[model samples]
Target: MSSSKKARTHPQYELLYWPGKMPGRGEFIRLVFEAAGVSYRDVSNEEENGMKIILDMISPESTGDSDSNPPVFAPPALRIPGEGKDGKALLIYQTPSILSYLGDRLGLAGEDEAEKAWVLSHALTALDLNNEAHDTHHPIAVAEFYEDQKEESLKKAKNFREVRIPKFLGFFERVLKGNEKQGEGKYLVGSKLSFADTTVWHVLNGLQFAFPKELGSRKKEFPTLFETFYQSVQEQSRLKEYLASDRRFPFSQGIYRYYPELDRQ
Candidate 1:
């Protein structure tokens, strides 16, 4: 039978995301790589590696002698280097796709086919919720800043807190509930950790940081999600250390923002 595990070839990966680390779409992939203890460059186009990111994506010159596939609209892409020095595959767009590829490549995915499918399902579910959380701020105007959308954000945030949060929370709870029924804990799958856990942790961190007032009041309501989030935070040694360290960066400019007016109850 073919091996489920893949050999690590090159650690140098070009993560084409925005410059800063805001735990956005790219973060889902990063959390897995971080957890698996893999080494990567994490090149972003807008922040630090902005120039190269631009050249690699939109710049036709970078295509060289190979086929082209740049990101459709924005960041969170991957460039897996090939045989020679500059030989790479331009994997563009979509969070779930990137995470799935990274998971299989790193051998941090599921055990069997069923387990892989289950983990991926939950992982995609988490991404859906992440996008929803982002929509609260830019629900009305994606082009404008949070300051410009405060009024809509305030109203939208309330809806997110009351309606959206519970619905998604319930979905996650059931996933956990299902896992428990199958006699599993610690992670989202029947046993070991997977993409689902990391995605949950990232969203929990964003929600708690962005909407403290609503998150605080409504947090205790989602028992399983809250508890799982807390446990994930505690047990994730590298992530915990990253949270405390400067490498993980701070939350200010990305998907989840802290606008005092929007945060309060």
Candidate 2:
């Protein structure tokens, strides 16, 4: 039995995130689980005291015990109960790290060492794009409200729309073209669907939601590589159903906020 296959032992998986309608970083992890047909409890929505649960886990008090696990700095953490070293709970945090770990376990990272490295590299790049998109609306500081930094956000948004978006999209397009030349199939890293493809799809989806007008106008520049890749992911039966279902949260004040003032063509 392969390790990846063995990892899917039907262990109790719980995702800890903010309880809201908006899909923040948690959505990326959700997509992987959904696509792999792995069932997990979304504690943020299902549990009555999900937020409190997360707080207690990350609190200083929780880490005082010699047997207690290390603290996770933020939300979108995955908790595998009784699966850690010495029978402790295993908590994985950070969007990229969590997704990469899940990808490896779910056979979405890649088949070999070189392909796995490429997948990680591309996934990190997608994360970079996601962060940049989020910063468009919260340029000054995450602690401050969007209204508090509207002026700075406008400048940042303009620069992002004019410069950063194109650079990232263009790089992906080139990657797609290169992959095609190498006969690696339509997916990003290899002929098969990998986590890198899913991460890129999420970033593109977020971009379209945040800057529909701008992305629409620039659609002709990158050819159909990215669009096709995104459509391919959407067509996956499990993911398609998840996307249309209520389980998939809509974009609002989250990372991909659509502010008319910040949007441009």
Best by TM-score: 2
- Local error of candidate 2 at 123, Å? 0.8
Encode model 1's per-residue lDDT on 1-265: one tens digit a residue. 0112545555566677766555667777777777776666666623565756645565544544253554345567766766234455656567888788888877656878888888889888777778878878888877887778778888987788788887877787777777775524457776666777888778877888888887788767767777764575447776666566555756776788777766655
Q: In model 1, which regions exceed 4 Å deviation?
A: 1-9, 45-52, 55-67, 83-90, 181-184
* Error of model 1, residue 135, in angstroms: 1.4
Candidate 1 has a TM-score of 0.83
Weakest 10 consecutive residues of candidate 2 by summed lDDT: 1-10
Clashes of each: 3, 0
TM-score of each: 0.83, 0.91
lDDT of model 1, residue 54 = 46
Report per-prediction Cα RMSD to one decimal. 5.2, 3.8
